[model samples]
Target: MKKTNYHTHTYRCGHANGNEEDMIQAAIDMGIEELGMCCHVPFPHYRKHLIRSLPSVRGVRSLLSLLKAIIKDGPNMRMPYRDMETHLELLSQYQKSYEDKIKIYKGFEAEGLSVYFDYYQKLLYEHKVDYLILGHHFHKHCISNDYFGKEKMTKKDIYLYCNDVEKALETNLFSYLAHPDLFLIGYNQFDLDVQTVSRRICQKAKDLNIPLEINAGGMRRGLKNINGEQLFLYPNAHFWDIASEVGNDVIIGFDAHDPSDFNDAMYNQMIKFAQDHRLHLIDHFDFLQGDFKKFQSEYDIR
Candidate 1:
């Protein structure tokens, strides 16, 4: 184990705290040798996308948040597009300054949005990012209403999540899948449908040689009693059991939102979780390139 974490967030993402240096220093202090700054991806025309997605918006909170994002051009769930240049530049500077202490990689944790497939591809092919991880939190749009982890996820929604993940994997754009079981967050029960999707996702990752992340964000939420069963929103026992049986490669992501999140206790807990499930844990993975040309030619994306 090299003590690496490829899933980390920065202050530019709005929801998280600390700058790139702060996060890197924290990781170094925790003896983390390799750290990837994978902030929530900033789109090129975020406001335009938000306005275009208005028809699909639902709920008071979701609508309000969408409006706020459109009005302020600030981070609602992701960093503002205008901030991307400065964010990456600063990370690049820190990468050099901290070269002796740690290995830093620039990346993004992105949703599987078809509209942004070109943008995501550009980020990689243009050398703007080293890698990307598929964190498919939304369906067609990034609004809370379309969020896969919302409390009201239906069987249809989970299936959609699985479908999006499978499609994203096929593109070979992402190095790994983040929180592959996030669909189980609000769905509560792990029934036959859940089992089917879980196996499908695990098998796909196994076949593609992409690692599945055991995200700590869900573990940080603590346990909940669902029908007399205590379970974390994700890294759900049922999901990982299927993954274990399928023999998918697993990686433990702190999913760090703050500097303090890079501690020993959480790391040990994640390790124990992997050990308990008999997961094939790996500390590193190959950063796969996004085959945009091939994808475009096959799907006629343009």
Candidate 2:
């Protein structure tokens, strides 16, 4: 049972639990062949102004410094880019130390900043990121500070999210699409609009030859009931049903926020989901096996 998940998160993202080593051990315990430490990429520019100013000017400045300290500690609250250097270092060290046991990869789950492509480019050039997965968790961009918060997405918003995803894919930077059906999180219903967007995404993925993840994080979080039907926000039956027809490469994501959740159950569920949908789920990705330097040169990566 060789399996790999390139959509894992770290404590630096302010949401996920566990240290990098903890995650590695958890992966080993579950017999995972490869584990990718794909923490959220930092948007330094977006973070600088996200934290509100305090009542007093000096106090506000103090707050900024304090937030910076927290970022330094790897919490990544109001600042994100601060900890990436350390994240890379940790991954590199752990990968070398544990090479005998299991395969480990260093990368980021990037929500590309379309408005600030230069900043995104800067990060790529600055760091030797192994791979980038397009995880579109926001509406327009992460800078909008807008979570996809509506109870039900309007047709316009659905298109916006899909467009953002397309833009990220066109950059030719991402190795695969993470949680491709994430747009359905807020949008509980399945209709023509959702189907259309899903097809558009799958079409691009087919064209690009990039794999789309059948994310397991949603199942670990718990199922949601919409219109009396139980389903995960992503790995939506409707979306995958369309994906099967579109014929895009698919992979499973552990999305391991807490290392303990990376278990046999998680692996089995992904296989079961893919089987139920008739998706040609990939057991391993060749992209993860090549030389990083060669990949960078080939894609002009950065």
C-alpha TM-score for every candidate? 0.97, 0.82
**Considering only N, C-alpha and C atoms within 3 Å, which residue pairs clash in candidate 2?**
none
For model 1, the stretches where C-alpha displacement exceeds 4 angstroms are 295-302
* C-alpha lDDT of residue 233 in model 2: 74
Best by TM-score: 1
How far in Å is the alpha carbon of 105 misplaced in model 1?
0.3
Model 1 Cα RMSD, Å?
1.8
In model 1, the worst 10-residue window by lDDT is: 293-302
**Per-residue lDDT over 67-130 for candidate 1, one digit per residue giving the tens place of the 0 to 100 score:** 9999988788898889899989998999899999999999999998877777788788789999
Give candidate 2 regions above 4 Å deviation: 49-79, 125-127, 140-145, 286-302
Model 2 deviation from the true structure expressed as Cα RMSD, one decimal place: 5.6
Candidate 2 structure quality by residue, lDDT tens digits, 22-44: 89988888777788888887765
lDDT of 2 at 48: 43
Clashes counted in candidate 1 amount to: 0
